[model samples]
Target: MMKIDIPTMRAQMAEGDKKRDTGLTEPTTITAIKELSYGPHGIENTFDIYYPVGTTTCLPTIVSIHGGGFFYGDKELYRFYTMYLASQGFTVVNFNYRLAPVHQYPAPLEDTNALMNWLLIHGKEHYVDTEQLFLVGDSAGGQLAEQYATLTSNPHYAGLMDFAIADVQFKAVGLNCGAYFIGQTGAINQDFPFYFGETLPEQTAQQFPVESFITTDFPPAFITTATHDFLKDVAEPLATILRSKGVEAEFHLYENPDGKELHHVFHLDQRNPIGKQCNEETLDFFRKFL
Candidate 1:
């Protein structure tokens, strides 16, 4: 496993994010609300909402989660992408959660649940159709999305976590190059402690064994990975497990046969044709659930 320097990696990503154009046009009909607090976990537990301008009618909601090896990233960094999704005629909720090495294990998960509860209570006010909700997460965030999906749909899994299964239900989920498998050897394995905290290795394994939580009730999924993405190995197996469980799922592998392959979360770069194509496909998949 590769050694990670979180600060350096974050700085690199921040620089890259600054240069990428969101490729979203004038919304002409969109409203963006920012920094809505969902809980007291910290300022990071806030979210942003975007939707059609002046629309009172309920609309499908797309809740997006950003990935940063469980140590970085926040809602602000994802604004452009989130707003672009909103301009496409859906209500989008992009949020920030407590980071690891500071907050640890279930903190992010709990923050997610609280956000859902907030949406359930306040979604109508923002014209969000609670009935038509979807989730989108990339990289480490993808792992959280998968975990949250299971906790919402699988009672047995929820019980193991010592919490009541959430009443929320997701219409579908878009997991982009997510790292679903947790255990590994090497420098990468060392990073687990930051998020899993001081929990026993066995307990940590049980808590995040995404594959074990799969069931027929799992929500439909739009899963994607790039030919060169580090997480490609797990992404395919996840989609396969979902399909095997009789859940509706689609797996897409973005490729570059003529040149170097796309990297992790390449979809964030709208300048890339392949990335743009993947985003369109993902949106189409989300629309099916609506």
Candidate 2:
């Protein structure tokens, strides 16, 4: 298993963000409203909305959940990429949840539930078509996305979390290099305590298995990963399971025969050519629901 030094990994991510900051550009035209609080969690529960500039037309909305091994990442780190999606003519809600090892499992998931409720109530003020909502997540956020998607449609799953799913219905779900499994203990994600809290890994897995929730009524999904991603192996099984359950699912593995390896959640960087293509393809998949 590959052990991660959280401190060093976080510093490296922040440094990368600094470098990417200077090269960031809007796709064509986009505007952002920053730091709007959605719930009572102070700044951690805030969200940013990005949409086309000077347009009041209701657009398909993409609610983005970011990835950082479940303990790191916020809307600020994801602004540029979300803005690019907005420029593509979708209203994007990029949000932050309280991090783990401090906030723990269901807290973040609860925050996700609350945010969706908030959007459903307040979305029209921003010209968001709540009926055409799509959920997008990367890496750890993918796990959150899958959970949220399932919770919204599965009463049993929603009962496990003790929160009713929001009234807003999802048009589709888009997962990028998602970490979808929590069953294995030796999967290089040793910080399960941050997510599982006092619960055992096996119990946590039983409670939140993405595969178990994949029924015919489940929404369509677009799942993407790269050959070099550490989480690559988990992607195919998820797509296969979704299909087996009679749900529409598409899985893409980005491979570069030229040997340029793309790591996990590469799409979040946006500078990677393959990542850019993957982002465009994911957005295209969302369009099918429209």
Candidate 3:
């Protein structure tokens, strides 16, 4: 296991307080579906769906997973951003998966995949386009999106899985300040052992490595991060690995003029120029691809 300083982690999180000054508000158009069975875990496996004002058919779909260092956060936290994407002619699905310390590695990953399977099976009923699927996630959620994409693309895994997931393909993926490496140290590590359990083997844990999963068949990706954020190094390394494998991956690094901005603040502060720019860049990227 890699060693990390507790005091340093606290200090880095404290720097994110700068986002509190930005005037960001929650979305009013979101409607929560508190009950959409996604996994065998029963009640906790539900997902929330967000859509535009008017009815539509064949619209693009985006699945958004929230970030909480893998141990915290809920589907409600990302309602605004999901609604914003919905407004742009895309159907948005925001779901809750079991967090770490409570559940573990494959648990959360399975929950996410189950939710996608559910959507693919019943998407048309909700006016969602099953054929046009895209994924967007922030922080740990971004990591999950990447992992899920890789799993779906790999014939060995997806083919053998008994889940309800159809052969539906992903159009594109957008990862913002994601922790590409789950079990590794540096920026991505944050009490990951609590999720995998203390007795789990190293080789077993390595299966979740985000960088190693990238493949030539993987969908196009748009990765972004800030200079002051600890995760700045995470996106570039993964992008490099993807490119080496002949995958189409694009990367962007945004630096905050104020030194106080930390990782995972883009969705929290909508008024900040940096936050708006991040949203714009992400939306533009998806629009072009989807």
- lDDT of candidates 1 onward, in order: 0.83, 0.82, 0.71
Better of 2 and 3 by lDDT: 2
Better of 2 and 3 by TM-score: 2
In candidate 3, what are the lDDT values of residues 1-290, reduced to their tens digit?
A: 54445355545644553345335554555433445666777655877776765555657888888876666666756666677777666788888889766687667777887777788788777767877888888887888888878877776545434454446678888888887876555323344665566677554555655566567888888888877667777889878877898877889887677676545546445556777777777778777775
Clashes of each: 0, 0, 0
Candidate 2 residue pairs in clash (backbone atoms < 3 Å)? none
Model 1 per-residue lDDT at 184: 38
- Tens-place lDDT per residue, model 2, 1-290, is 33456678789978877776677765558878888999998999999888998878889999999898877889888888889888898999999998876787777788988998898888888878898999999889998888788878777766666567788679999988888866544432355664556445554556745557656777899999898999999899889988998889999999776988878877877777787898899989989889
Tell me how far candidate 1 lies from the true structure as C-alpha RMSD in angstroms: 2.6
Candidate numbers, best lDDT first, in rank order: 1, 2, 3
Candidate 3 achieves a global lDDT of 0.71
Task: List candidate 3 segments past 4 Å from native.
Answer: 1-35, 40-43, 157-166, 183-191, 201-203, 206-208, 257-262
* Candidate 2 residue spans exceeding 4 A from truth: 1-5, 26-28, 184-191, 198-206
Model 3 reaches what TM-score against the true structure?
0.82
1 versus 3: better TM-score goes to: 1
lDDT of 1 by residue, 128-210 (tens): 88899999999989999998998888887887775455578999999999988675333224556666654455655666556
Name model 1 segments beyond 4 Å from true: 1-3, 21-28, 184-191, 198-203
